[model samples]
Target: MKQLTLAGAIAAVCGTTFSSTAVLAQPSAQAADQSEIMELIVTGSRSPERLDEVTASVTVVDAEALQQDLQLTAELQNILSFRVPGLAPTTNSTSNFGQTLRGRTTLVMIDGVPQSTPLRNGALDVRTIDPAALQRVEVVKGATSIYGNGAAGGIINYITRQAGEDAFNVSLTQQVGMNAEETDDTASFRSSATIDGTVERFSYVFNATVDDNGVQRDAEGDIIGQALYGLSGVRTQSLFAKLGYQIDDDKSLSFTANYYDAEQVDRLIDVTSSINDGTKTYAVKPAPGQTFPGEPQGVDGNSNFVLQYRDAQLLSNTSLTVDAYTQEIENVFFYSTTFADPAAGFSGGNSVIVSEKEGLRLNLESVFDLSGVEATFIYGADVLNDVTSQPLADVRSWVPEMDMSNEALYLQSKFVIDDWVLKAGVRDESVDIDVPDYTTLRMCGANNVCRGGNPVEGGKLSYSDTTYNAGVRYNFSTAFSPFVSYSQGFDVSDLGLLLRAASVPDLDQVQTEASVIDHYELGVAGRYRALNYEFAIYESESELGTATVENPPGSGLYVPVRAPQEIEGWELALGLTVNESLELGTTYTYVEGQDPDTGAYIDARKIAPPKFTAWADYTVGNGLSASLQWMKVMNRNRFAPVDPVTGRYTGAEAPVEGYDVFNLSALYSRDNWRVSLGFENLFNEAYFPARAQAFTYAGYNTMGLGRTVKAGLTVEF
Candidate 1:
C-alpha cells in the first residue's frame, strides 16, 4: 500500500486541495468555519506538514476554542487539563506541580523559542505568557529529538497572534466576575487591547492586558489561603509586540518583544488545619504583623526579545531561516516565618531565583524530486547559553551560579509516494556545564530546625548524545488513516539542584549521567460524515527513571532518585457535529507507570487517574450560543497511607475517591460586539481534586472553588 503526504491526506479528508500558503496564512478562528476537517499546518514540526500527514499523535487548539467562554482562564494549566487528554489535572494553584504530559515533564515553547528552565525545573514555564496573546497552541505528543534536549515527553508550542491583511484593526475585551457564594471582595477584573495591521510591505501587531483577582472562596464561603501557592488575590500585566518587514516576495525580517509581571497580594494568611483522618480543612485571618494581610508573596517577571530573518526562495528549491533570541526570568517565593532557619541567615524572609538565556537557531529546508518520489529535507543547528542562580531576599546565595552551553545539529527527511508518507530524523547534541566552588549557607536557626547543605566541590562537566526517530503513515482513506512511530529523547539531570547538594570533594567524582527515554506509539485518526475521531496507544520507558525524593530522611531536603521504569497509556477523542447549530464531543485518557525492580507505582506523582470529559454546544437563533461541559475523574489507590505527623507513607494503602464537576457558558454576538457569561462549578459541588486527596500533606487538599460567575464583552473595529 502506498502512503499519502500530509497535503494529500488533507485533500482526501476535506475533498478539496487547499493552497498550502492560504491555509497557513489564515487565522485559526476563520479557518474553522471554512472546512469541516481541520487542516492547520503543524508548527512544532521543523518542516511544513499537516496534522494528519505526520506519524505522531498531535493535537491543535485553535483561537476560537481558546476564546470560548468556558475555556477562558488566567491560568493556562486549567485550559489544558480539559483539552489535552494525556495531560495531568491542574493543581488549581499558581504552581504547576505534578502537571505532566504523558506522565513526563514536557518542554514548553513560544514560536520555537524554549521557555522551560530545565536546569532548575521550577515548574513555572506554563504561566510565563498570558493566553490572550496567543493565536493557537500545538501539542506534539511523544518523545522527539528534532528540537534537541528536554523534550522527553513532548513539546507545546504557543503561536502568537499575527497582523491581519487589513490596513488597520483594533480589538478590546473586558471581563468582570465574582464568587457567587461570596461577592464581597471576591470580585475579579480583566481587560485586554490589541492593534494590528499590514501596510504595504510591513506588518505589525501589539497587545496589552491587565488582570486583578480578589480573594478566592470555597463552597463554604471561607477565604482560600495562600497554601499550595494559590493564585488568589493576584495582579498580572503583560505587553507584547511584533514588527515585520518584507524585503521581497521571498525574503522577510521580523522582531518580537514580550514582557510579563505577576505578584500575589497577601490579604490573609493560611491557617489551615493539618490533615486528619485523610481530611483537611482551611481557614484564613488577618496577619499578625502590620503588613497588608495580602502583602506580595510571589512575584514573577519574564521578558523575551527575538529577531528573525527568512528567505523562502534562497535557491530554486530551498529556503533558509535564522533566529536570535534572549530571555530573562525571575521568580520569588512567599516569605515564611515558620520555615525560616536563622542559621541560614533567614529571619522570616523570602527567596528568589533568576535565569537568563540567549540562543541562535538556523535552519534550511529543501525539496527534491527523485524519479517519481517527492522528498522534503530539513536541516538545522542551534547554539544556546544559559545562566541561573538562587539567592535569599537578603542577598545570600542559596544555589551558586551555574553556566551551561548547548550545541546541536539535526536533519529530517520526509518522503511521499502515491498515498504513503515516511519520515526519519536524527540529532547530535552536546552540552557543557560550569560551576564555581562556594561555601554552603548555614540553614538552621537557634529555635528552628534546618536542613544543612553540602559544602565541597566545584568543577565542569560535559555530555553528548545522538538521538533518532522514524515513522510510517498510510492514508488508506481520509476516513481511516493509521500510523506507527518510534523515537528517543535525552535529558540531563537537574544540574543546579545536584551541584547545590553535592558533598563530594571534586565535581568529577559526582555521578551525573543523562537519561535516555524511548517512546513507541500506534495511532489512527479519521473523519466520516459528521463525526471525527482519533485513538492512540503508547509506551515510554527509561532504564533510569528520575524522580525527586526526600533525602536524609526528615531533613526536608530533596534529591533525585533513578530506577528502571516504564509507562503506558492510551488516549481517545471523538467529536460529532449534529447539524449547523449543534456539536458534541468527548475525551478519555488512562495512564499507569511502575518501577520494574521495586514493583511499585513509581510515577504516582506524575500519573493522573482515568478521566472522561463530555461537552455539548448548541447555537440558537439571533446569534446566541450555549455550552455545557462535564468532567469525571475515576478513583485511584496507588500509594499507601501516610502518617500525618511523620509525613511518611504507612504500610496500608487506601484508595482516593473520585469527583465530578460541571460548567456552563453562553455567548451572544451581534454586529461588531460580543457578550459572554460563564458559570463554573455550576452544581456547587464540594469535592477534592485527585491531587488534594493523594498528597494531603503537601496542601494539595485545598478545597475546589465554589460556584463562580464571569461576564465579559468584546468590541472589534
Candidate 2:
C-alpha cells in the first residue's frame, strides 16, 4: 500500500533518499550484502524474491537501519536488538521477556499479519508495532512451516511504509530525551507524522506515532525498575494506514490498518534486591508520596487489519496472491508476588492476554521450463482463527477460553539448473482446540507456595502434521557459494503456559502434544573483490522440550517440561568495502542448548550467550554522516547456584557474567532540514543486562541503560 513517496517513489522504491533513510547501515558494505549488491526478500518467498534466490539466512534491516534505531531507542526491543543478528538480549522490558530468535520462538510480523500471542504467550509479542510505523525488517534464519503456526525460531517480518513519489506530501518528526545522569523528572518525548501521495491510480499512506517515556537510569544512576518488566513511565501510541489501487495493468489492491498502545504509568516502586546477597534491583519513589499497586501493566488494544489482492496473470503461467486479516491483543502482566493467593483473598494477581485473530492467505505462482529446469511453483492456502484467554484482574479463570482452529496446505518448489538452486517444501497441518472446563486457581508463586486448585478436565484437542522442506544451492564462483538446508516446524507453543499450571486431573494427563521442530542448515557465501561473507551452521531438534520450568524455588511461575532438546548454532557475517566513503562490518553468534537426556545446560530460560556485533560507517560528502557500534554479551556459566541434589535454586540456572555496549550515530541533510544524533550507553559502562545476568527471577536483577542522548528533527511538506 502507499506510504513512502518522497519524490519519484524514493528513487523508484528505495534506491535511497528521504535524507537517505536515516543512515547507519549506509556504507560498510551493508555487512551481509558485503558488496555483491542484490537484496530483496518478501520474507523469503512470499513474493519479492532475490538474495540470489534464497536458500535461507536472510537479515535485511533497512530503512536507514530503521532510522538508526530511532537514534538510540524507541524500543522495538531496542529495534530488534540493534538490527537483528541472532537476536536474544533485550529484556529492557515492556515484555519481549527473553527476546529470542535463534534461541527459538520468534514469529512476529506486521505486514504479514500475526503478532504472536501463540495461545497465551503473554510475552507481549515484541511490543506489537511502532518503530514509528516501520518500512523495513525481515529476518528468516531457520525453522519454518513457511508462515503457519509459531515459527520455531525464525521469521520477524515487519515491513510497512510505502508509496513515495509525492503527488501530495507531508512529514515531520521530533524527539526529546533524558537521563544522561539526571534530567529532572526524567523527560522523554517523541512525535512522528507522515502523510503520503500519488493519485490517478490512487495510492496513499498515513502514520502517526507518539511516545512519552521517562524514568530510566542505570549505570549507577539508579532507578530503572518496574519489576521484571520495567522501563518506567511509559506511554506509546501508533496508528498507520495505507491504501492503494491499480487493478488494471495486471491488478493490485491493498489496504492496511494498525493500531498499538502501551502503558505502564509509573510512579515507581520495587526497590528490592538480593541476588542471594550479590544485590542489584532498583527503581524508587513510592514511599515519600505513596502510590504503586494493581492494574497498569503493558500493551492493550493492539490491532492490525489487512486486505490485499494481486494478480499479474492468475493463469497462463499463473500468479495470484490474496490475504485478509484481523488481529487483536491485550497483554498485561506485572502485579507480582507472581500471583499470590494467601488463601484466596489474594495478595497479588495480574494476568490478561486476550488474543484474537482471523486470517486467510492464498498464494500461487508458476512459471515453466520443467525439463530444462527453470521451473518454479509456489502454492498455498492457510486459514486460522484463534481466540485465547487468560483472565485474572480478579475475574479469575487463569487460562480458559481456548478455541482455536487452523488449517494449512502448502507446496513450494523452485529450480534453476544452470547455476544451480533447488528447493522443495510441503506442509499439511490441521489443528483444532476447544477447552472449557476451567478451574485451576489457588495460586501463589515466587515461593509463597500454595499449589493449585485443579479440576482440569477440558476437552477436544487435536493436531495433525506433515511438515517437510529441502534445499540446495551452488552458484560457485568468487570463492564460494554453498548452501544446504532442511526445515520443519509445527508447534502449539505456550498452551497458556500449560493451561494455567494445571495439576492435571485430565486434559489427557496434560502432555498437550503438538511440537515437531527439526531444522538443520549449513552454509557458505562469497565475494572477494570487496570481501562479502556469510557462514551458517545450525541444528535444532525437538522431541518435545521447548523449555519452561521453574518449579517451587523463586517461582515466577513457569511450567511445561517434556525434555529432549538439541540446539546448536553458528553464524558469521563480514562485510568490507573499505572504499566509497568507508565501510566495515562484523557479526558473530554462538548458541548452545542441551538435555537430550541430562546433558544439562538447557535453561538460561532458553539459551543465549556469546553474541557480538561491530560496526563502522563513514561518509564525508556534503550532507555528513557518522556511525559506530559495538555490542557484546559473552561469558556463560551454566548452573550451580545450589542444586547439589536439588537444594533449591534451579531458577533457570544463573551466571551470565557478561556485558558491553557502545553506540553513536550522526546524520545531516542539506535540504528541507534533517538532523540527528545518537548515543546510547555509549561508554557509561556499569553493565548488568543479559537479563540482569541470567535470570533467577526476583525482578530480574535490573540495571542497564545509562548514558543516553538522542536528538532529532525533520520536516517536509
Candidate 3:
C-alpha cells in the first residue's frame, strides 16, 4: 500500500512539470503591457485606505495567488520561510511546535483576535484555516497597535472572504496529489456562495463556505515527521459566515463569524516504538501511555481529538467605531513514555490532558481633521482567561486547577504632517496567576532528585506595566518613503517561572513576573514605475527569557533557566514587472543572535539558517502561465557531544549541510474555470534538520522530504 502511494506521488510531480513545460514557452505582449491598479484594503488599522498611504510594513497574499500554487506542501511557517525575510520556523525537540518572528516577540491574530494562549501552549496552529476561505493575508512586521497582549515580535492577520458587490454567486474547488514516497495521497474539497441586494432602507450581503482537506507523505510511503506532530494524516473542517448592512449614506454596520473544527487520529511510527525485555527483544504493538500524578505502572492514553473555535465581529462608524469578538478552545491529549529501564520498567501508564481557553477584545477609534493636519486616535481594552485540568491516580491526576485572568487597556495616535507620518501608542497590562502553597506529591528531597511536590496554598500573583512605541516616516516621493521606529513589548512570564522553579531554591519568589523587549528598526519602502521594493534592518533585545531543555537530565531533573539575548537581522524584497505578462520577485534574509555578555552564538535548534529565495513567472495569451522558484538555506552549527564522560550538548556539530530546491508550476484559466499543476523539489536534494528528541529517547535527526507534485481545478460563477 505504501509503495503504491509513493509511486503515485512521484508520477504526479513528473507529470505536471512535463505537461506544462511547453505551454510556458510563449509570452503574450498584451498580457505583459497591462498596468495594475492600487485599491488594497488597509489592515492593522481602524480605518480603510490604500496600501501606499499606510504607515506600516505590509505583505499581501491574494486569493488567486494561493490558488495558482498547486504544491501547497508548505504550511504557514513554510510559506513565510522564503516569502518573508528574517522569519523562520522553530525546529525544537518538542511535539506540536511552531516558528517565531524576529527571534522572539511576534503575535498571531485571526481576523484581529489573538490566537496564542498563555496556559494551553504557545501560539495556535498556523495551518488551522485554509487559504481557500481567505480573501487575503496582511502581515504587519513590527510591534505597533495593541489589540490583545503577547504580540512582541509582529502580527499576522488573515482576512476572511466576504460577499463581493455583485448578484448571487457560487464557487467550488478540488485538489489531489501524491509524492515520490509510497502510500502518500492528499485531497481537498471546498464550496462557497454569496448573495447581496437592497430592500427599502436596508442593504445586506451574506457569505458562507465549507472546506475539507487531505494529507501528504514521504518517499518511502511513510508519513514524514512534522516538527509539531509526528507522523501525518490530520484533517480539518470549517464553516464561515459574514453579514453587512448600510445604515446611512456615510455610515455602515458589518458582522462576521467563523466556526472551525479539526482533528487527527493516532499514527504509529516504526522507529519511535520499542519492544524489549533486557536480553530479549520483540517487534510488536506497544500499549498507549498516560500521565498520572503518582503511578509507576500500566499504559493508558487516547489519540482521537478535535479543536473548535469561533469568532464574531460587529462594527459601525459615526461618533465611534467599535470592533469586538470572543474565542474559546477545548482539547484532550493522551499518551505516555518509559523513561528509565526498558525491562522491569517497561510498564508506565499514560496521561490524560485537558486544556481550555477564552478571550475577549473591544476597540474604538475616531478620526478628526484639524486645519491642514489629520490625526487618527484609537483606544481599546481586552480580557483573557485560561483554565487547565487533569484527573488520575497516576499521570492523569486532576485536583481541578486554573490560572488567573489578565486585563489591559491601550491607546494610540497617528498624525500626518505634510510628507511625514508620526505615530505612538501605549498599553497598561496586568496578569493575575493562582497557585497552591505546596503539591501533595513527594519532593525529590535533599539529594537534589525530585518528583511532584506538595500542593501549594492557593494564592494570586498580579503585576502591571506600561509598554509603548514611537515611529516616524518621511515621504520622499509619491511612491517612496523611509521610516524609523522603536517599540517596547512586555509579556507575563508565568511559564518562565514554572520552569525556573525546577532548579530554584525558593518557589515563592518565582511568582508570575513580566519580561520586556525593546525593538529598533529603520527601513524604506515604495513603488517606482514598474518596480516595488522594501529594505529593513532591525535589532531586538530581551531582558528575561530562557533556553529550555525539554528532555530529562541524567540524574537530576534540571528544568529550564532564564537568560538574556540580543537578536539582529535585515530583510530585503524586490518585485519587478518585466512588461505586462512577466513578473520577477525575490526575498533575502540574514540573521545573528547571541548572549550579550558571553557572546556565544545561540543554539542552532531554535533558529532558521540564513536563506535566499527567488521566483519568476511568465504568462501566455488565453489562460496559460508558468513559474519557477529557487530556495536555499545555509548550513547551521548545532549542539553535539562534548565529551564521553559528560552527556551534554556543549559545542557544535560537524556542520550539517544545507540544501537548494527548485519548483515549477503551471496554470490554465478561462472566465470562471481554472486548473493548476505543480512540481516540488524537482531535483530531490537531500538534507537534514539539526536534531530533535521528541518521540524517541535518542537525539535523532530526521531527513527532509524529497520530490513531490500536485494538481487542482476550480470553477466560479
Candidate 4:
C-alpha cells in the first residue's frame, strides 16, 4: 500500500521530532476541504504524494468560493476568468496587466509569494490582487516540480487569509452600485481581523485591504478609445502584511509584505489632424502637442513592491520548502508633442520617459519518499536590474542610456507510480545588456551643418537559454483524470531599443536576439457530488513571441508584428450544487490565431471567442444572497491590416462580431457585517470592434466598458 503510505509519512515526521501535537497536527494531516483537496502535497512532489498520484493538472479555487465571489469586484483576472478553466483574459487592446492561461504564460503567487517584477517588464497583474486578501486560489495547470524558470505558463497560488479557530474575529464591508449608463459609479470599503488563542504555543495570521476604483465608459457613455485605454480615472492603493512564527513545531516561519500603488490617467487622444477652411483637409482631430517642460498635465506613474520569506520542514516523511524574495518597480512615461505644420514647417520636441527596476529571487523545495520511489524537488535563482532615463522637449541630438541585467538558474523534478504520474523540468537563463556613450549634432538645409558621428558609449549585451518541462497522468476514478504536457518559454530583446535602431556600421555583430515557442497541451479533469469539471486543448508555434514587434522608437512608423502565429484552443468548466439554496458556476473559452506569414488572421487574436460564462446563486434566509453572471464572446472574422502601399484595408475590420456581457450580484451577511451589490454590463453590451489596431493614432477601437455598477461593504473581526 505504497509502503504503508510511506510509513505514515515517516511516522508523521518522527512525531514531529518528539511531538508538539505532531507539529500542530501537520497542516490538517492532508485533507480537509475542497472535496478532500485531492490528496496533494509537495507542489510537484518534492516528497509528499497524492495529487491523484501526480501527473500534473491542478486548479483549485475555493476559499468559500472566493469569499462568495468577492461580492462583486476584486478583479483578480476578473475572478479568474469567470471561475477558472484553462484561464483566459487578454485583449481589450492588450496590457491590462496581461493574463493568459491555456495560451500560455502563467505564474502568479501570494502566500508562496513572488509576484514577478524582473525590473517590471514581464508577468504581473493578477488583476491587482484582492480576493479580499485571498484565502485560496491554487491552480497548477502545468510546468513545475515546483516553480523553476518562470513557471512557463502555469501556477497561481494566492492562499492568504489565515488565523481561525477563532478567539477574536471581526469583519466589515460597505457597498453602492449604478451602471447601465449610470456612468460607472461604484464604491467599496473593508476591514478584517482574526486572532487565535495560545501564547506559549504560537499561531497568528493578519490581513488588510483598501480598494477604490471607478471610471469606465463605452455603451455611449463615452471613453474607451483603446490602446491601453487612455488611462481613465485610474486610482489604486493597497497594503498587505503577514507574520508567522511557530518555533516549537518542528520549525516554521513566515514574513510577507505587499504594497501596490495603482495610478491611472487616461484621457489624452490626438492623432494628427488640421484644417481651417480649405475644405477641412481630411478629418481626424486632436494633434497639436509639445509640452513637458516641468511636467503636470495628465501625469503618469506605475508602481510595485513585495517582500517575502518562508521556511518549512518535516523531516520524518520528507518535506521541506524555502523561498526568498525582493521586487520593486517604478515606470513613468509622459507625452505631448508638436511639429507638423509651423506654416508649412515643423520642429518636433516633447518627451518624458523614466523607468526604474530591481528584482531578486531564490527558491528551494524538497518532498521525500526515497526507497518507495516517490520524489519531488526544485531549485532556483533569479536576478534583474534595470534603469532608464529620458527627459526632453523639442529635440536634442543625444541618446544612448539604459542599463539592463538578468540572470537565472533552475531545476525541477517529479515522480510517482500506481496509476501513473511523472513530470520533469529544467531551466537556464541569462541576459545582460548595458548601454551608454553618445554624441550627435544635426542641422541641414538653409545653413548646412551636420557633423560626423561615432560617439555613443557603454557596451555589454548577453543572452542565454534552456527551458523544459514534461508531464503525464491517469486516473479513472475519484471523479476522473487525464493529462499530458510539454513546455518551453523564453524572452529577451530590447537591447537598449535595438541598438538605437541599427543605423548600421559594425552594429556590434548584428544579433538582435531571438527565441520563441513550439508548445502543445491536452487535458481533462473531474469532480463529483454537486459536479465540477475542466477541459483543455492547445497548440502553439511562434517564430518569436509577440508576433512581429515594433512600437518603441517614437510610437510612429508602427507595426506590432503579425506574420508568424498559429494558435488553436479550447476550454470549459462547470460547477453546480443546486440544493440548499443553490450555487452554480460556468466557464468557456475558444481561441484561434493565424498568419503563418500572410494567410491573414489577427483581429487581436480573435478576441477569445467561443463564449459562454455563467454564475448563479441563491441563499435567501435571514442573511440573504443572490448572484447572476453571463458573458459570451464569439464573433470571428475580424481582420484589418493590409496596406503595403494601397492594398487597402487600412485598419479595423475582420469580424468584430462577438459580444455579450451581464452581471448582477447581491448579498447581505449578519455577524460581522457585509453588503454587496453589483450590476455590470447588464444589457448594455456595446463593445466596438473588440481588438482594433492599425497604425493607431487613436482613431477608435478601444471599446468594451458599457455598463458598470458596483458596491461593497466588508467587516470582520
**lDDT per prediction?**
0.73, 0.76, 0.51, 0.50
Between candidates 1 and 4, the TM-score winner: 1
Q: Return the top candidate by TM-score.
A: 1
Best prediction by lDDT: 2
Model 4 poorest 10 in a row by lDDT: 19-28
Residue 151, model 2: lDDT of 86
Alpha carbon deviation, residue 470, candidate 1 (Å): 0.9
Q: What lDDT tens digits, residue by residue, belong to model 2 across residues 193-225?
A: 989898889999998988888888887888887
How far residue 272's Cα lies from its native spot in candidate 1, in Å, is 3.3
- Candidate 3 on 1-717: residue-level lDDT in tens? 011232243234332111000000001111111133244544545345445445455566655555554345434555555455566533421232425566554565666655554443433445445455576666666545364446656666777766655545556666665565443344443444444544544444444444333444433344444323432344444555566665565456666665555444333333432111011111112257732322321112111111212121233322344455555543323223322223323233332333344565555666667788887776777677655443333442323354657788887777777876667777788877665444432333333444554344546666677887666667667456676666667755425225323333344544345567766666777667777667777776666753444434322233343577677777777777788788887777666667676666665434556777778888887889888878776666544445445433332223435667777888889999888787766666654433332112232344444466667677777
Give one digit per residue, the lDDT tens place, for model 4 in 23-84.
00000111112366455444443334554554345555656666655665555666666665
- Which runs in model 4 stand beyond 4 Å of their true positions? 1-80, 83-91, 98-217, 226-412, 419-431, 434-477, 480-526, 533-682, 685-704, 707-717
Q: Order of all candidates by TM-score, from best down to worst? A: 1, 3, 2, 4
